[model samples]
Target chain A: MDATERPVADLPAQRDGQEVIHLDRVEKVFEVRRRAGLLRREKREVRAVDGLSFSVGRGEVVGFVGPNGAGKSTTIKMLTGILTPSAGTLRVAGVEPARDRARLARRIGVVFGQRTTLWWDLPLLDSYQLIHRMYRVPDARYRENLDRCVELLGLGDLLDVPVRQLSLGQRMRGDIAAALLHDPEVLYLDEPTIGLDVVSKANVRHFLADLNAERGTTVLLTTHDLTDIEQLCRRVMVIDHGRLMYDGEVAGLHRIAEVERTLVVDLATEMAPIALESARTVKVEGPRQWLAFPAGQPAAPIVAEIAAGWPLVDLSLREPDIEDVISLMYAGRSAG
Target chain B: MAHGPGRAALYAAVAAKGFRRYATYRAATLAGIFTNTVFGVILAQTYLALWAERPGLGGYDQAQALTFVWIGQSLHMAVAAMGGGSEEELMERIRSGDIAVDLYRPVDLQLWWLAQDAGRACFQLFARGALPLAFGALVFDLALPASPGTWIAFLTAVALGLLVSFGIRYLVALSAFWLLDGAGVGQLAWLVGMFFSGMMLPLNVFPGLLGEVARVLPWSSILQLPADVLLGVHTGTGLLGVYAFQLAWAAALLAAGRALQSLATRRVVVQGG
Candidate 1:
């Protein structure tokens, strides 16, 4: 009955504990069309993921941070069997995602932000019920999971309401619950916090943190939100332009890139771009503008001066969180 | 695929529950009804005009042609009735790579989708298709059949037509796996089916060699064959053969559907994040 000693291949499609995901030299290349003119055409291949590989340990919460086209989703897709890899080996819950996709389905859970896995026209409760059956949760187990999800997500009132009627925050909560209903060993959350109000976003972060600690679920979270990486994952995977930039601790990301941080001033009046004592505004717009600073800076003084500026309507300090660091890494990638 | 109640029933339950949940989209269903009725009028008008000059084109009388147009409206709403033939949702899933979760679920993907689609289509048929058909009948001096046998034959033909349409749409959806623009693929499929599937006109009415080719393809079955049956043109053993062919074609398309699904899944290439 123990899961540890099972043959890597005999790895039951459903994994509950330890080493939920493993990947070796995984790559994903996409073929895109480039038309120059009415007559001219070109076929270009984008290396969305290039020979990038890493494994998610049991109960490990890994952050998949990337820019817009960074290969975060690609990595998750390859891991989950939604897309076949151009090259390399990928495994989750002891099954090869590509070949054993169906078997893997029962063992892993997934949530996509901005998209409800729940039926749009149906009640949230009904969507949960559907997921319960879709994953073949035992009746008793389904109840247990459902109860937990409702309690955790505070979905009591919204459960009976149709998905279309619910707010985005409510829908997201419902989506999270639906993914967890199956009790999969690994949960792939793609931008699960996108567009959520800060409070709702916090709730999801907290819930995810708790979910991993309590259930020992290997959670691979992909997001542009740096706070997600900071709050959830100690291990981080950075992908850019369809290639793995770095795979290591979250701290290593800032070190890998000359992290670019920006400070914006909501100026009361217009002014030309000014060079900062410590850094420069890489690029600037009119009065309401941005000033780029080296990753590590004494932000307190800068904010204080800005707050004291006569024309400054509002002033806020920003740092390169996960998105900035990952983008820099991506922009620095070696071309194929 | 799994025999156990836990998984198979779970999928069915989810699909059923999801379908029930979708029933709440009264607004959507209502909108569909309005659109379908408008389209039905257009179809009915065309049918009425086509048979006006000819005494019988493929056995269609004045009344029967109207029936065919009405039935086509119903089938268009029915084939993927609820949500079965949505290439857009599929494309979004693919783009976001959310389809990974879908691929993992322990159920027949096609069946699960087909069931949900049925929910939408069924709602449209009642809310939009049937209502439009009735309105068309009332407004236009369309013929009503004299015998119950005509009704039975018509029903059989309409059902067959539904199967054929569903198969064709599903085939079109498979194009999303590879196509950069899923909508383009879907549009192409719609355009081809519209021209050849007899959505616009009976295959017999086509001016030249195109008409001959149209008959060979199942597109004609979407509207033409059902209309033919409704008009009471196919008599005696011919009826049996036509019904048999319809069923046979459905079975063949079902096989093709399975094949396309497998092929598309295999072709999935998770692109850049």
Candidate 2:
């Protein structure tokens, strides 16, 4: 059926044990208003997440990467049962989140780097304890989990400090600790490394990498940090303008960009001119020039010809990196 | 399955911790206290000026009239105003996906709110609303309840009346599921409650069917019942009956709020910001 034809009566998402998060043609639209003054009004709908359908396997670390406002947060909110989707079906932890949001809260832990979930004025430990009780973690299990978190996150020193008094880095640790107090099966992190210093960012990434490996906890992290994608997630999904544009292994992204190989050369003569066809000029600097082969073009013959014909001094070849690949992907869609 | 004292205790701990949260809070509570007093004084002076030398108006003497103003002013900040914030808080949380954390609580969300609210309600009564009321009475040299029994009954009536008021506010706040922001509706809800609860004046003075309507509505319980106790017009059987009605209203609102929350959660799309 067409998206608009999907009835609202379609039940909340249902899941079995293996699948932790699922979005079946899920779409979200926000009804907004533009005022022409005070009384006059215009209604508009913003499609933050278009018909998205995917599922997260247990213990899988999936990197959900997108440009800012490409509907990353909206997708996470729907998965975790925070906002109701305008269309499609969504399920998390054996239930539809939008349908039974409160019920799903126990199984999921969500953290947004821009906002701390811990109570602002309370000590970090107190806030965690409150969450511990809130999620009804058993006394012994709560203590065990907390002790591990504080130790793992190195939060012992900051536990007594109120959330507001803690530094941004300290607060992030506390927020992570608070979210984990219940030991949720899935952890949804939104821009967890945003704006952090290098050392802190590394510590967070290391902790996250370790957490995913040790617990086999399913992690769905949405971040703009390419390094995070490279470090932790094997599979990266890219979305832009509310649509899923790419879903594959990191290496597939690299291969797509690897189609073009760059050749850099230095001119032996000051007035030397290099001419080439079936190739593209990418960069020129000082006495060096770089040209790219269109995927199937032979680099060895082209280089031999350049060396024989032009006053080429030396040459080197390199493949495109992850940044180049993803940028190309984003750049492709933004054009049309 | 139900809200019990244990849940209230947890919520109270949350609230007590929240009470100390005052130090960081924008001096908002202190300002709120001042507003409470200002509102009380306005009602008192307005009535006193109109009454002139007359001892009573509409079957209420100076003490009764003054008590009504104090209770209404005190309640405006405590139970009623505290819950009014729920709508915006709920909307923001839902939009941000930060709400995921709140969902996991083993405690029922409604009960959780009840506990947290109990804390806020207590803080407002003691720090923001009631303390100012005490000072206002002293500053204005207002008549006091003469008997110890009257004070006891007044506290009971205040507590019961507050439960009713809290229930009504929570129900209004739950509208966030349908309306993006329920603050305007919540505020309007309280004002509507004020109309029937006699916050503006004695309900008896409203006349005809309106008075009968006010007598049965939850609004009258906000202040009128407590004021009646303070003036020594209510007690014993009458006090218990008022408490029963308050408890009933609280239960009804709870049922309705939970049903709404469940319905909302089921249909939630929880996607991008």
Candidate 3:
């Protein structure tokens, strides 16, 4: 019980190379009663997570990608013990999340991109201090983590600022730092790069990469951004309609679907669609055109040709989303 | 209990953060203080007129009635037994699925909320309660406890009363787990608390069985019991009995709240997904 005095080394050692997150036939069914009419009520069971099963080893950065209402949020909630599973076994860091939520909370950290866990009215530092006490992070460890988060997340200037006043990027960074302050062994990130600019997204990705490398922090990242998956995760799991659609390498999923990458180009003038050798024009508006190129093909040549032939104002590449891949996978299966 | 000091330190820190959170709303606090003071004056005048007509009605003189008015005003915000506070925020969180963040913490959910509520009540006791009481005493010659010991007992009663209030509100807040929207329940609780907490009128003044029933209900601890203690109505062993009564209700309500919380957590529906 002397957790304060007992050093990390003095604690019971974990099993060597154990699976940090494990799920077997996990299912969550929600009973929703909607007003069918003026008086009649309809009771239906929604299988949010249907027999989902996966296991991640220590230090694995696995990306869990899905479209909206694809059971990613439900799975995350169950993993964090915010909601209990209707059936099946789920464990994180050797503890059942729903049964021993508080015990597991000491070892796992969670971040939701859409919502902040920080105190809305308090300064960023105050929230961190409260977290420090809440988690019982030792004084020295708390200082060390705070200093590291400040340095790495560029939160030095933002510490004294109230969280409500921070920009989205700054607040997102603050949230990431707050979750990591407790030095949890496993980190669950839900849409970590959902709504961030290119620079902030890159910074977050870089920080997460370094964190995994430096601390061996096992990360379960659920995101819509393919680039986030491509950059940070080697193994990615794709879920659709509450079921596992694909589970393997990120590159394999892209290749199997033969998904097209979109190149949105803004032309200088409202001219006819520019025909290209490698890319096909999908849609065209006044002064703007969307080009579809094979996911495997390089966009550099297409960009070079377009830039040389047409008066190009500005252009950006949109990576194929997980939803695109999942839909394409279904399309491929049906076509075959 | 084994992690006594560490757990205490964590909840104390949380309580301190809760206090600082309320302190940030400087303008709101000032507005609240002003509103409580005005209500105190209005209620005092009404009580003065009634006590004058009745002449020591319900074992209270005019001065004692005035004191009850100010005390009730002070406690309305401090105890917040009539609802509308963090409980509403908690309900909103449940509806918005933001309670996920709260559930992620390692601490006991019920105790964490209790600590936070305690912090808010303690701050309101001074920031919004004391001033109205001072104003009533200055303007209306309210009943004052002569002994320092009685003041200490009164403060203790107030603390216990806060626990009772928190317990009741917590139960109402957790109803959001099943109801999804606790607004209706919150209003009902507020109406019941207002009628029984001796806020609208002292429970002692209630006629017949209504007074007996209101005096024994948990709401009485929020205002009536504490007010009675301060007025020297409950003395010696009688005072201890009043405290014991408050303690029992607080314990019972809090335990019931804890039970409901566990039940709610078991089947959490986290609205968004």
Pick the DockQ winner: 3
Query: By DockQ, highest first, what's the ranking?
Result: 3, 1, 2
lDDT of 2: 0.72
Q: Put down candidate 3 lDDT per residue, A1-336, tens digits, no spaces.
A: 111232323212322347788899999898889999999999999998999998887777888988999999999999998889999999898898888888889899999998899999989999998899888898999999999999999999999999999999999999999999999999999988878987898899999988988888989999987778877877789998899988876677767776578999999999999898799999999999999987556678999999999999999989778777778888888988
Relative to the true structure, candidate 3 reaches a TM of 0.92
What is the C-alpha local distance difference test score of each model? 0.71, 0.72, 0.87
The regions of model 2 sitting more than 4 angstroms off are A1-53, A68-71, A83-103, A241-243, A258-327, A330-336, B1-9, B23-42, B81-107, B136-149, B176-183, B193-195, B266-272
Question: Can you give the lDDT of residue A243 in candidate 1?
Answer: 60
State residue B143's C-alpha deviation in candidate 1, in Å. Answer: 5.0
Q: Ten residues in a row with the worst lDDT in model 2 chain B? A: B81-90
Q: What are the per-residue Cα lDDT tens digits for candidate 1 across A1-336?
A: 322233334222333345667777888777877997998989998887887866666767777877776677767777877788888888887798878777888888888785557777667777677766666677899999889888988999998787888988888888888888888888999989888776897799888888877777778888877767766776777776666667776666666676555778777677766545776766556677787765444456766666665366776656456665654655666531
Going through the candidates in order, what fraction of the true interface contacts does each contain?
Answer: 0.78, 0.43, 0.84
Pick the TM-score winner.
3
- Considering DockQ, which of the candidate structures 1 and 3 is the better prediction for this target? 3
Worst 10 residues of 1 chain A by lDDT: A2-11
DockQ of 3: 0.67
Candidate 3 collision pairs: none
In CAPRI terms, model 3 is classed as: medium
TM-score for chain A of every candidate model? 0.76, 0.74, 0.86
